[model samples]
Target: MSELTTLARPYAVAVYKRAKETGTADKWSDALAFVTLLMQDEQLAKAAANPKANREQFSEAFLGLCKDHLDTEAQNFVRLLIRNRRLDLVKYIAELFNQYKAEDEGYIEVDVSTAFPLKDAEQARLSSVLERVLEKKARLRVDVDPTLIGGVYIKAGDRVIDASIRGQVERLAKRLWT
Candidate 1:
């Protein structure tokens, strides 16, 4: 995981820079998503790895698959990836690029896991509190986990606040044993 992330960092940075300069972060996001999906297709992987495949052949096949979705700049980006044999890195590159873009835009992707489904009012209140605490716009993705017993666990980037009853019980048991 770390190695893939290391290999992907430079590509992500370069793409982010270009996107920032051209005001096309959203476009790049869509392009990267398309490429990432293409990379996931088994047939495409076989084609990409074929010993007989040349850059032109690969690019033609790839572009043909994406012709309807990508613009010229996106096509050039795909060509560059093919030329550099970096098509395999598309997923990691897209993930890292989105991370960078989110940071640049002062937005945080947060995961909130609750014991049960959240009502609209509850979700709105949580969002309000999170926005205030994080001091930025919060893009919250919520999930339900009955095993949590009660309360919620919130993860924002590298920070995690585990307020679930299950978590508290585990911590208390550990303290008692120690």
Candidate 2:
């Protein structure tokens, strides 16, 4: 994991820098996201990682798949990754690029899990509160997990706020033991 991260960081940085200069971070994000999707496909991933596959042929096929979604610069980026045999790192690059984009845009990526799906009003209220607490705009990825029992669980970077019914019960049980 560390090795992959180390290899991916430089590519992410370069992409982020290019996006910043071109004033096209959103476009770059979309392009990288498309690449990420392709890489996630089992067949395509296998083809990309197959050591016996001809490099030039695969690169052409890959770029062909990306033709509509990627701009010229992004196509070049894909070519560079193919040349470096780092196509497998597309997901990590996209993730790191998003981190860079979010930090620069004064936003925090937050995960909010609830026992039930959040209403639009609830989501707005929660987002507003989190923005205040985190001191950055909150970009929430909300999910519903039945195991949470009730209420919400929020995570941002290393911080976690557990307000779920199961968490409350666990805390209470621990206190009673003490």
Measured by lDDT, the strongest candidate is 2
lDDT by residue for model 1 over 86-164, one digit each (tens)?
7888899998998899899999888999999999999989999999998988888999999999999999877899999
3: Cα error in model 1, Å: 1.4
Per-residue C-alpha lDDT of model 2 across residues 95-175, encoded as one tens digit per residue: 899999999999989999999999999999999999999999999999999998999999986699999999999999999
| lDDT, residue 127, candidate 1 | 92
Estimate the overall C-alpha local distance difference test score of candidate 2: 0.94
Q: Candidate 1 — which residues are off by over 4 angstroms?
A: 46-53, 113-115, 143-153, 163-178
Instruction: Work out candidate 1's RMSD over C-alphas.
Output: 3.1
Model 1 residue 23 distance off true place after TM-score fit, in angstroms:
1.0
TM-score of each: 0.77, 0.87
Quote model 1's TM-score: 0.77
What C-alpha lDDT do the candidate models reach, one value each? Answer: 0.90, 0.94
Error of 2 at 85 (Å): 1.2
